[model samples]
Target: MSAIACASLSALVAPSLCRALPALAVAPRLLTAFPTATRQPAALSRRMVTSASLTPTIEDILVEDHRQFGEIMRRYNLATEKAEKKAALAELIRQVAVHSVGEEKILYPILEKIAIKGDAKAVIARERQEHKQVRDMLYDLLDRNLPVGDPLFERDVEAMYKYLAAHCAGEEVSDCPEMARFFPESARREFGKRFLAVKKLAEDQVAEEILDMESKINL
Candidate 1:
């Protein structure tokens, strides 16, 4: 009889055995769901490593950053402690600022050039407006210096999150993919490198500002 049938029979004939029967029935499914790991030959593993090390394109970099930013926001939302939430919020601010600036400085200019002429100005303008709204909200949050748990702070953070989520969705759906089509693979890779460099520079600037603030506090 099938394991499920056995389980049903056990339930009918022996209630105490029914629970154990279900476990027996589920065991094979659990094993199938998660196969046991096995060591591969060293040479095969090394080959796999080489294959995995291939460089990512511009789209890959942007998409990965979006994913990371989403994760930071998630961490901020899930953080129960004030200190933990503050830290997560600060990191999220830095990342959002850097990512927006990098796109504006490096990515958007290329996009503008490659974009269809009639729509280019309008698209770039709209994206810039969205970025401006986010930055304005961020500045307001920073200026308040309120505890993360404060009602005002929570409200502003939620607003910022909603705006950012919408902006990211638009870029992922329309902007990045359209811009990517205009560039050759080699040029796209180069753009990716430039994007990272610009983002790093922006992050450094934010770090310096943070250090300046902390130093003032210590003084």
Candidate 2:
């Protein structure tokens, strides 16, 4: 009779123990389902560096510009009136000018040294010429307050935009590859440092100029 009673008690207690053990184990997991904080965004300097000694490539710079330029183009396309178009055009010009300055300050000299004549020089030179052409067009757009549908405004800005897109694509595919192939590891790094320094300086100057101009225009 005593043995029978102990068996009966054991059967009842085993199921309860199993359920309690699982509940205890799973409690912490359930509690952790609440939202939690995350790490802050990475810094720009930290992002571009891969290895301790590796240099940033022209491809990297151009790729960044492509992303930024695409956004500006989208904004321009969405603009409604002359005022909106003008604002978009201003932003586009500002971006292109800053980008050109950065490339000239940092990228051009490096490519000019490594690239062979005819193909390389012409390619790089053409990009510089495009920059000048676009700058002139941008100046015209800004100086003259014309309707968005006007032929002059449409022709100049669209031409500049098309030229810029093609130029950027060529740099990423052809010129940048040549630059990377020609330079030594150390040379690449040195070039990258110089480019970054000059790029920063140019960006600051562009920003200041834009702010002053905007202030004058009350934009």
Candidate 3:
């Protein structure tokens, strides 16, 4: 049985389980230098944390991402215009797709370097499975070939919203916060920096590919 995406999102290892379980946050050590990313336009980089940020931990970054995901979904649901809805859904897919991978590749694996409980590894396994489900849903969203105005397009987008809402909620509650329980503050910050780098790298490459794919999506 797979735990659904918190974005596992976070609940699998709550504070009560902290002492008994292991940590799953990103960052094994302080990164001597922040990773480089090509600069992006202000509009495209709406929710990203910059290198200039004085002090935001990785938890803050992930939480903010969850919030952004929700907001994009709401925008998609509320949008009356085709263009409006299309943009919102495209952004939602891009953010969730990338963030999920970031956690898998950067966030959780670093924590594996430390001594972790069997349950924690199990939680990570579930999260990885959840990520697979999410990826499948995203591909389904695209493969449906439904344009913004089609009723079926609305149906699929709504379905994605519900799934992601559950995923984000679980992560914010348990997965995100427990990251701080075991790791030092520097590790958290380093993870944030690394995650942001991933986001920046995706800006032109992944986001554009998704936008182009969704625009042409029509049954």
Q: Candidates' lDDT values, in order? A: 0.56, 0.52, 0.56
lDDT of 1: 0.56
Cand. 3 TM to true fold = 0.69
TM-score list, all predictions: 0.68, 0.61, 0.69
RMSD of each: 22.8, 27.5, 12.8
Clashes of each: 0, 0, 9
lDDT of 2 by residue, 1-219 (tens): 123222322132111110000000000111111112131111222345577566664445556656688788778778776667667766765666666675765566555544444555666666666666655555555467655657776775676677667666555555545544555445545555555555555556667556543332212
Q: Please write out the lDDT profile of model 3 over residues 1-219, one tens digit for every residue.
A: 111222232332222111110111221221211121232212222534565754456667777777788888888778888788777876776677677656665666654443145655655565556666666666766777767778776776677667666655555554554555555566667667676665665455456556665666553
Worst 10 residues of 2 by lDDT: 18-27
Window of ten residues with lowest summed lDDT in model 3: 15-24
lDDT leaderboard ranking: 3, 1, 2
What residue runs in model 1 are displaced by over 4 Å at the alpha carbon? 1-54, 210-219
- Among all candidates shown, the one with the greatest lDDT: 3
* Deviation in Å, model 3, residue 143 alpha carbon: 1.9
Which tens-of-lDDT digit does each residue in 1-219 have in candidate 1? 223222321122211110000000000111111112232212221222123445455566666667777899899789888777777776776677677766776666665554445555566667777776676666666577766678887887787787777676556555555534454555556666666666776666556554433232110
